[model samples]
Target: MSDPHSTAPVPSPRRRVGRPAGRRAGDTTTRDRILDSARQHFARGSYSSTTIRAIAADADVNPALVIHYFGSKRDLFGATLRLPLHLRDQVSALIRTDPDDMGEHVVRLFLTAWRDQNVRTPLSAMIRSVFSDEGAADALGQFLATHLLGPLVAASRRDRPELRVSLAASHLAGLVIGRHILGVAPLARADIEQLVACVGPVIQHYLTGRLPAVPTE
Candidate 1:
């Protein structure tokens, strides 16, 4: 070695510096902007109507960034449509109590949950998607059947409870769709107490009231 003690050429501190740090910060900002824009777009219309390019433009970011952050439109939609309540747990608790007035309790719980800001936007988006997209329709039906209906049916523990649970759930679902989703007339304008009074007995009938059985003859 000509000079073992000689120091190796010092690496330039400049080599360690450039746009990487700035680029990373910019990326994070861009991702947040994209998500905010996406939520706004989805809230105003169905998922089918909100395009990725439009969201990217609204966010003031490149289209690629939207895909990079949220993967696809479906994935983004799902992310945006999350509920405020722990639906399974809440419904399970309500049904487990075996209340005599289950319908009133259920309706109250539903209305209260829907009134939350976080819940309302997602629910509105889901409702719009269900009407406009076949995939969304299937997803929403499956979600309702599994989470909403399935739990109540399992917890009913009464005779021929499947039919009862399904009927009750259908009635409640229709009420919500008409009033909240479709914004139907009197139903939409009706106060919460009025709705509960009008709808509770129908659900109660489905849940517990006796019906004529088919004749064996």
Candidate 2:
């Protein structure tokens, strides 16, 4: 028999030099990989910041394929949230409105969605996840910033569009967290129509009115 050490030395796995060795050759799993990538990114950091290219890189697929399979980042987020809410259609209505009346539309649509049990359960889960899990928070935050507020900002002449988005989102998030999720006293018991009228004006103010100036030196 040849000597035990007769073979030449084997290379040490090439150290995988860069990018932590993302997935490869996803012929059957390309679509799944995109989702996997999206889930990973959404769950890992600021979900609002995750991009199509970033997800594609993670899944070892082309960015175009992400579009092919999911159409857009917002759609991908909907899939990730996996809620049955007619979220895409609801959100679509926001961009096609008169800017001055945008707040009422946003509030009305939000309350309308919460009216359905099928929609509320998953939405509750999404909000709960945002509260309890960093990754989930990232994902939801990203989804709201990109899907909900981004369009509003584009159509807004509001100073500090980013702040406008944050204000409006925070208002809605608080309403849901308190009224729906936590079942706060009067809010939980109030009529949806009442809440819409009450909150709609507030949201419009946030979206369009000038802020009171902070006292300064």
Q: Best TM-score goes to which candidate?
A: 1
RMSD versus native structure for model 2: 9.5
In candidate 1, stretches whose alpha carbon ends up further than 4 angstroms from where it belongs are 1-41, 50-82, 85-89, 158-166, 207-217
**TM-score for every candidate vs. truth?**
0.62, 0.59
Model 2 segments beyond 4 Å from truth?
Answer: 1-78, 82-87, 116-119, 213-217
lDDT of 1 by residue, 131-191 (tens): 6697666545554555555566556666776677667766766787898878899988889
What is the C-alpha local distance difference test score of each model?
0.70, 0.71
lDDT of 1 at 83: 50
User: Which candidate's lDDT is highest?
Assistant: 2
Model 2, 1-217: lDDT tens digits are 6688778786777664444333344554666667667767765554446788899887766687788778887677666655344776667767777888888888777777776754555456567667655655555566567767767766776677777888888888889899987989999988877888899989998888787776799
**lDDT of candidate 2?**
0.71
